[model samples]
Target: MSDTKSAVGYTRLSQTSDASIPDQKREIRNLADREGFALLNIYDDGQRSSGFDAERPEYLEMQAELETGEVDVLVVRDRDRLSRDKRERSMFYYDLDEWDVELWTTTDGRVEFTDDESWLIEMIRNYMDDVTKRREIQKAKKKVQERVDNGYWQGRPPFGFRLDSDKRYLEPDPGKFDTALTVLQMRENGATWSEIEDETGVSAGTISRILDNEERYLSHVE
Candidate 1:
């Protein structure tokens, strides 16, 4: 059997301008080769946010591999590629310890968890990343709310309404307004969600939103 250690790479991209997945992969592969590790696979979470709550399919898959205890090393371009949330990163570090997997990064080289000083440095880094992510989220929400305050629609219009000529406000769609009205009437007449869905082809979820925000939909038609 070959003496080379087995390694697997992971990459994640949250934005278009961030380091490309290909670039991260190349960096991980180069690092693995230079360190005499035999790279077994490279997992990617394309366009997936590093938020703690975000459901990353590839990240989960990589974790499952780690649980098998066959992977000797986990490679990434940087620690942030693993997670931006400090709490989440700490939990992951614990799991890596349990699985006996070494984490190698192109920027930081091998991560050493052997000392309090090293742990402090990692804690500081994770804290900074979490702050930056939260600020970006706040900025994005502010921009979206500003647009809504300016009488502009923030996202896709509801089922029965379309954006007006300028695409700034919601207007009743002539083709679907009657259907919307029918759905509301049916629900008010004690029609079940499944019955309405069967009659109008509008999903129960969409029908719920339409009923919940009935005033907003009615405002356009009135």
Candidate 2:
């Protein structure tokens, strides 16, 4: 058997706007080659949000493989690529400790788990990553809110509305106006949200919003 250590690379791009996965993979592969590690495979979570509650199939697969003792080391472009959440990072570190697996990163080199100093450094890194991610999220939300306040619709248009010529303000969808009117009529006639949903094919929550914003819908009518 070869003396080379077996390793698997993990790459994650938290958002579509984030850096490309290929770049991360290339860096990890280069590190592995330079370190004389036999890169067994690469697990990529492309364009998947790394929110605490988000599910990452590729990360889970990598964890499963780690449990099998086949992978001696886990490679990532950086610690944040593994996780930015402190709780998640702690849990992953515990697993690595339990499995006797080493973690190597291109940015920080090999993560030394044997010393308190190393652990403290890793904790500080995780905290910094968390702060940076939270700030970015706040900035994004503020921008979205500002757009909405400026009468620019974000994401998809509502059921009975479509983007206007400039693709900013929402205008009533001509084809769906009748359906919207019918929904309003049904609600005013004492129809339950569920009943209206079944009859009109619009969701109950959306029906509620439509009814709540009834004046806006009616304003478009001649």
Candidate 3:
């Protein structure tokens, strides 16, 4: 119980850290020792920008340790002390929640699963995490809806159309688009989905597949 390798402490900053490693290190080591954690490692990134997505090697390394069960808990001053970006911070919290790793923040000291007050804390955490996820989903849905209204290609184009050099618009491929028109007219003529596929020399499956794609009808001229 007097050992010092049981948990890892991760500290970060979005811009530049006004805090120092020696300072944060002192606090974490003291906290862990007080709680009887062995104090595995203290991961720090002094001047790293959080703007670089997935570029924090130290953070990723800490996550790897968590995955391999190398630590009993992860301590931070607060979630923002981990990362200001919501997605990245949520990523760590989500993985910890799944792995059942004790997440502690001195801002709200000593969060633990066995604590009597944990249930209420956990309920609030769940609600907060849910709100974060819902906001992300709603943002994605809005982007897609906007794209559809503008007739911009939000997804890959059908076999006949290819994405433009900029990957923005879908441009008609002469062979594929003409063939598509043939298949479309055939469908309009009461030809079966399979028949149109066979007659057009485009696979019956491919023909049928294109018809089922929402972009075929929904993607518009922007």
Candidate 4:
């Protein structure tokens, strides 16, 4: 084991992360055992988004270890576990290259810095991850809009409103609706935004927006 490569595994699960972490770890372990790599440790970022600016504590720790030359190879369940953004994946790839650490994945296979085709394949894998995430996001947004059109709230209910018992539509809050209506009436009576804010305790910006979107708010009032 001492003469073999000191390898560390990294796994991340964002969307399907709950059921996939164990599976990822098992695959990495099996690979290490079969390939005779000296498995040093496994790092995981559970439920952490693979976004460009996400705070991945375990991933950062792994990078620090890589910098210190503790690991000769890095293993992951997939390239998306490292990053879904091309810029971030490229940055991580170069950093690992600088540290002379190889990358092994269950999905895209092993990548050594000296292997030119390996780098191209890794890039293609990361690019595909980004494309998949974008498509998922677009589909989610379309579904949300469809729900909104059907009079269902896509997210949390606004102030002075609550989600109905079925958790689909926004319903007027018995305690807060009167105040909201009074605020709206004041705005209708030529009250300034600041005046509405002072009377209703809602922010001036919010009050202005509520007044501006007449069809959305007034429809509820009627």
Predicted model with the maximum lDDT: 1
Worst 10 residues of 2 by lDDT: 46-55
For each candidate, how many residue pairs have backbone atoms clashing (under 3 Å)?
0, 0, 3, 0
Q: What digit string (tens of lDDT, one per residue) describes model 4 on residues 75-176?
A: 887767788788798889999999999888876678765777868876787788788888988898999899889888787666678888988977788867
TM-score winner among the candidates? Answer: 2
RMSD (CA, angstroms), candidate 4: 6.3
Measured against the true structure, the TM-scores of the candidates, in listed sequence, are 0.68, 0.70, 0.46, 0.65
Question: What order do candidates take by TM-score, descending?
Answer: 2, 1, 4, 3
Tens-digit per-residue lDDT, 123-222, candidate 3: 5665575567467658979999997788777887777888888777878776877787777678878998768866888887777776776356335324
Cα shift from native, residue 54, model 3 (Å): 3.4
Q: Write the per-residue lDDT of candidate 2 for residues 49-116, one digit (tens) a residue.
A: 57454368988889999999987999998888888787788778989989999999988899998889
lDDT of 1 by residue, 1-222 (tens): 877889999998887867998999999999998999999999988775655654688889999999999989999998888988889888898899889999999988999988899888888888999988899989999999998899899799888888998989888888688888989999999999999999999988889888998888777665
How far residue 222's Cα lies from its native spot in candidate 4, in Å, is: 19
Candidate 2 similarity to native, TM-score: 0.70
Arranged by lDDT, best first: 1, 2, 4, 3
For candidate 1, the 10 contiguous residues with the lowest summed lDDT are: 46-55
Which portions of model 2 miss their true places by more than 4 Å? 156-167, 170-222
Q: What's the lDDT for all of these models? A: 0.88, 0.87, 0.70, 0.80
